[model samples]
Every structure is written in structure tokens, then in C-alpha cells.
Target: MKRQFKKHFSHNSELKCFFYRLHFHYDFYKKWGSTTPISLSFWVFTFHVRENICNLTLKGSVTVKIISVTRIIDDMGRIVLPSNARKALNLEEDYLIMRIDNKKHHIKFSSSGRGKEVPIDESGRIPISPDYMNKLGWETGTEIGLFMQGEEGVLQGNAPSCVICGSNQALLLVKKTHVCEDCIHTGTEASAEKWSAVLNDLFQEYKQYCEAAVTFTNTEDVHKARTKGRRLRTLIQFIGIKKEHPLYKCLKEAHDILGKVREDDVFIDAFDKEAENNQYSELYRKFIQKAEEEREEHRNELKQKLPHIIDDEFSARWKTFSQDELKDCVYKLDIETALQKYEKEFSERVIKYQKIKDKKSDKGLDSLHSVRKKAKKLRYIYNFLDLVQSIDYSRKSRQYKKIQKDYGDIIDLRDWINETGSLGEDIQDDHDDVKKVRKQLNQRLKRLVKQVEL
Candidate 1:
């Protein structure tokens, strides 16, 4: 039972209690299934089954008081979603996402809206949200391109009109996401502000989809993880954040996991064609040998990250557990207790550095970015602790998960590029490959920094 339980709720100590309770109920159900007590605890963290978009969807648009969305549930355990919210959001199901606005926070129900294609500018760049833009490294003056096909839909009246088409229907709003079906036929362009709001959300959405692919099965069926991993690597480079930033490590980890699988797959697929062509065998052999050496170097580097893994068990049993057990059992440790300590320390440090960052007047110093980056690490640690107590474990933590997936790709790419440089041979193809990879690394790094920052 413990082993099976671990498969689902392995990381967090708090969940152990819930698991036992659930198992107990299950046993009771077997003996007296109809008479089994239906209690609130049974639905504690479970999403309500009856919630759906129809219950919350708005007809067009409505101004809503954000504070109304942040109501806390009382002991009665009933929640009546406000009429405005219910109609505006069209929420029906129990899955909840908190949206923090300027005035207050709102509890939103998650719904699977049919995805729409985003319009791209003549340079083939997709319009992205500000948050997503920060995540994807598309700040001012970044070059881009767009390619779309088919007729999509008319843009909202308030949306920005197409640069060329001048049609109001062709426009898209600043914060909202839009997909352009006519982009392939007639390409458009956008200003930086128009697309920045959705960048983080878009990238996050894509990243989450990739992470989810690994949950149902051992392997990733979706190729987006690898593809987006490379893009994120490129963004990482563009940002030029320090290697120590938590975001850097997060992307590094994510890239490493997906990269290994990608590299292995790519290598195998290419192996057959290269092997069959005797005329090109020599060149292919060199490439394959270099790739293998690079993989080994990367594998060794990734192994070094495990030492930093926080042990939740130690913190939980600080008062009662045996010394040896306290030292050894991270999973068994009470993470909530330990996190309080970490948070207190982090708050003090942040306040101290923020004071320093405030002292510098005229322009924001580069060191401020470093200080901000450190604060981000604290945020990440806090988030991880929060997750340690739940079933979400790794699936929802994109920053850390991405790092675990993609670090190998960065290391391997670095080594491969280095080898090509050191050999001093006229391997133009090798150099091109290295350049391509470096570009990907930069993007990934940019992505890492963005997420690492608060």
C-alpha cells in the first residue's frame, strides 16, 4: 500500500495523512459501499465534478469587482460564485486558478477553450502576452517572422488593426490572445506593447502541455517539449542572466530532461540513413563519435544537481525523529515546518538587498537584476515547499521541471561547440550545428531568467 501510495503521492509528507485517510475510506467502502460516510475531507483537495464553463461564462464583457472573487469559504463549506463572475468566466468545473488583478484576486474555473491561432507579423512573429513575452525573450527590437494559413475570425472592435490590411476585424487586443488564420495569405506586423502581455502565458501553456505528456506515460508523445525547450534555451542566452539564477537552473533542468530524449531520438533516426550511405560514412562517423562524447560529458554534469535537493522529512521531524532519520529522510520530513524557516530567512535577505537596490538612484544597476534573481530563488524554494505537500509534485512546477529536462542539452551543446573549436578542423557543418545549438541555449537561458525573476 505504501509503495503504491508513493507512486501517486511520493514527494510530500503532508499527503501521507491524506493518503491513509483515503485508503481507510476505500476499505470501508468495500464492506459497506452504500453506507460509507460522505464527508468534506473526501473532497478537500478534489476538484468539484459539476463545475463547467456554462456556469461562469460571460456573454460579451463586464466590469467586475476583483475583491468579490477572493472570498474565503466558511466552515459550512459552501461557496456561491458571484453571478457576474459565473457569467463572465462561464466556469462550471471544480478546477480553480487564481487570477490576481490590481484590486484583488479572483478564483477562476479552468475550461478547455478551443485554441485559436495567433496572428504573426510579416517577420513571422506570433503575438504574445506581456508575461509570455518576458518568458520568451521578445522585448523591444527583436527580429521575428509570421506564417499563417486559412481564414480565422474577425478581431474584436477594440483590437489593433493590421498594419497592412487596415481592417478592424484583422486586429487583436493588447492583453488578450489571438490566432490569425489569414497570416499565410496576408502577413501582418505588431508593435512590442501589443503582444507582450500573452508571451509568458503562451510559453507557460506550451511548457505545461509538454510536462503533462510525461505524466500519463513514461515517455513524451508531444514533440513540443523538445522544440520549445530549444526555443527557451535560445531565450535564456538572449537575457544574459547569471548562471546562478534559479530560473537559469530551472530551464537548465527542464531542457536536460527533454533534450536527452530528443537527442537520443534524433540520433537514432539519423543513424539509418547515415549508415546506409557508405560514401558519407566517414563524416557521419565523426559526427556520431562527437555526439557520444558530448552526451557523456553532459550526463556527468546533470548528476551534480541532486545534492541540492531539499529533504522535507528532516524538517518535519526536527523535534521528535531520531538524529539519523532526521538527517536521512527528506520525503518524510515536515516540509511546512521547514519552509517557515526558509521563508523567514529569505524575507530578511530580500529586505536587506532591496534597501541596497533602492539606494542606487539614476538608473537601475545590473546588480539589481542579480539581487532580484536571488529573491526569485527564494520564491522558487517556497513554491517547491508548497508543492511538496500535494499530488502535483513535479507536473506543475515548470521552472524546476524544465531544468531537469533540458540541462543536458545545454551541457552537451557547450561541449560539442568546444570540441569543434578545439579540433580546428574545417568542420563547417559541425560549426553550424554548434551555432544552432548555441542559439537555442540562449533562448532557453532567457526563458530561465524570466521565470526565475519574480
Candidate 2:
């Protein structure tokens, strides 16, 4: 494969560029399945049909190889791009990529939406975003006709659209398209003020959740408060806020503190219901009481978070996020475009979950739990795009929800059993209780797998 790859560049002057990166890990890359790195286009060039490797420059538009190169991060977290590759790729001394603002464009392509700003170095070569190009089905050796737009080196609103998506928002035009940041980049960027207001309100509510920690009357409020705390934490992360700052740590600690309370509450609810009308209600009464006691003990643990959550410093930091201005509202992604970009992710997750379904072992169950959480994220993006209204959405939703519910039940029962052991109150015949629940869980999971038909 090295000889094969080397031969392609053997006669080309750019052989030095190709050999430096690929030779470093030739065997590893050959084993790659669906997962590709940042530089998808160049590898894609290598993957293209030889017969289709031709480019027709529109006027002066020159297409070029936008190969992806992954740099290893040292222990100190620094990446060094080699000089030969940089020169060959026309990279700048200090590369800067300011995110593209979709709101600035008067006429926006609502279909494709927004994406990341293409990084332009001090040197003039623009790194092509392969997302749309791949969508356009271009090969690696495709020639990109390079052209300058506007006068005085100031690219005007007439900046070339992405070579792929045709979005004129930022400088993503490798002569035309912006580099793809993943399927999530495109979508809404309506008004910065509204985003700020919404974030402010959410942050305020998060603070309220912390304030009401002691007053929460039931598991529902506790669940919602925990969910809100997590959502607030993720909102800033999605917006690329100052991540390492104390504010992120506060949000993380707040959610983590609530996480225990929520987990215990879920176990209590699951067990209490199972025991409610059972013939052995009398026998299970003590177990229910034990569960409730455990939940309360964890709830009291929230007191530890009060000082940090209630402090003005923490409140002020969150308020700063609310003040951020996002001109565009990135709420919708192009469904077809997104599917093309994320199909590999969507496929591999399903495959992974399938491989773990029958393994009732502890480690397997832990992995299954992680997969369910990830499935929820996939569902979120699909629904956010309103892909739910599509023809097959209902079936797809059904298959995953069934799988998630089964795993949820198994996890709940497992946690309940674990919690029983830790509650310090001896429940007689605990083995019988766990065995009964495990048998039922196994039966339900089998049925769910059949229904999913995967």
C-alpha cells in the first residue's frame, strides 16, 4: 500500500508532501473503516474512482487536493506541522480561523445553513473544506481553480461561496465551500440578542435549581433540576465558551452533585412501583422504606454544593455566558447534507450497541449504558433537524426507543440492587429479589432485540 500510494505521487513534485504524513502510519490508515480524520478530502482523493479524477475550472476556479493530515499531540499538548508539508500545502505561519457568521449574509442558503470559517494563513493557500466537496463527489487530484475576489484584498460580501454547499457566509470558499466542521455546523443564526436572552434565562434557572436543592419535594423536581443543570453546562460547551474557566467546573460540579440524587430517585421510583400492588407488598414495604432512606441520604449530600453554587462569583460567571451575542441561531441542519456527513457515526453506534446487547456481564452493561446515552444525542440532532417528520423516522425512533427502554430498566434494577447493598439495612433474601429482576430484564431485552430487527 505504501508503494501504491507512493507511486501515485512518485512523478509529482508534491511527492514530498504525500510521503511525509502517510509514511508515518501507512499500515494503520489502510485498516481504517468508516472513521476518517479532519483531512477527509485528501484521503478521499486516494479512495476515488480513477476514471472520475478530472476537474473543469469554471472561469479561473482552480481545484486542488485538500488532504487531511493528523498531527500527534505530545505530552505537553502541542502539535507540530512539518515544514515541508506546510510549504507544500501553502499553510500560513500562524493559522487563524474566525468562525463564519451566517447572519451577516443578506441572502442565506437555509437548506445547507452555516459551517466553520475556513482557516486562511498569512500565506495565501486556502485549505479546502471537504464536506461539500465530498458531497459533490470530487476526487483527490481534482484541480481547484484559485481566484481572488473583491479589491484592496478585502473580500466583500461577494466572497465566493463554499465550493460544496454554496454558502457565502464566511471565507470557506476553497474558491467556493467552507471546511466542514461536522454535520452540526449548518442551521440557525438568526439573532444574537434572542440567544443571549435565552441563555440568560437558562442560566438563571440553573441557579434556581441549585437554590431549590434542599426544597425539592419529590424525584420529578430533582430529575428536572439535574437535567437542567446538565443542559446549561452543555449549552456553553456547544457555543464554545471559555471551557477551562471556573464557570465550567462549577457547572460540572453542580450537575455531578445532583447526579447521585437523581440516580437514587430513579431506583426508588422503579422499585416502589414494582412493590406497590404486588401480593408481597407487606414483604417489600421495608425494601421501599430502605430505598427512600437511601435517596434522602444522597439528597442531603447537596448541602456540600451550596456554598459554591450560591456564591456571587459563580452566578456572575454564568451571567457572562448569557451576555454572549450569537448573530445566527444554529438550530436546524440540512437533513440530507447531515446524513451524508454523519452516516458513518450513525451506523457504527448501532453496530456497537448490537454487539453488546446479549452480554449481561458487568462491563458489557456499562458499555450498553454509554451507548444509550449516545443514541439520545443522535436522536437529538435528528429531531432538531425535524427529521422526525420524514417517512421512516417513526420506525427508526421506535427501534431505538425500545432498545433504550430495555437498557434503562436493566440499569435501574442493577442500581437498585447495588444501592440495597450500600444502604446498611439488611434486606433478607436480597439474592431472590435481584435474581427475579435479572430474569425479567433478560426476557424483556430479548423481546426488544427481536422488535428492533437489527
Winning model by lDDT: 2
Write down the lDDT of every candidate, Cα atoms only.
0.36, 0.46
Q: Encode model 1's per-residue lDDT on 1-454: one tens digit a residue.
A: 4565554444434444555543232432243334434333222222111011111112221112121112322233223343343344443443323221223221112223334223323322223335533444444444322211121111111233332223323322211212122321221111111112222443555456454535424234335655554444333332233456444455566566556645544553454355466555555566566556655554444334322221233123222322222222331223334445645654565455455543322222233333434334444443433322223423334544444344334333334334435442545556555455435545654454334332
lDDT of 2 at 323: 49
Q: Provide the lDDT at 187 for model 1.
A: 16
List candidate 2 segments past 4 Å from native: 1-190, 241-245, 324-346, 379-407, 420-425, 428-454
RMSD each, Å: 27.7, 19.7
Model 1 sits at a Cα RMSD from the real structure of 27.7
The backbone clash count of each candidate, in order, is: 92, 26
TM-score of 1: 0.23
Candidate 1 local lDDT, residue 169: 37
List where candidate 1 sits over 4 angstroms from the true fold: 1-285, 290-334, 340-399, 402-412, 423-454
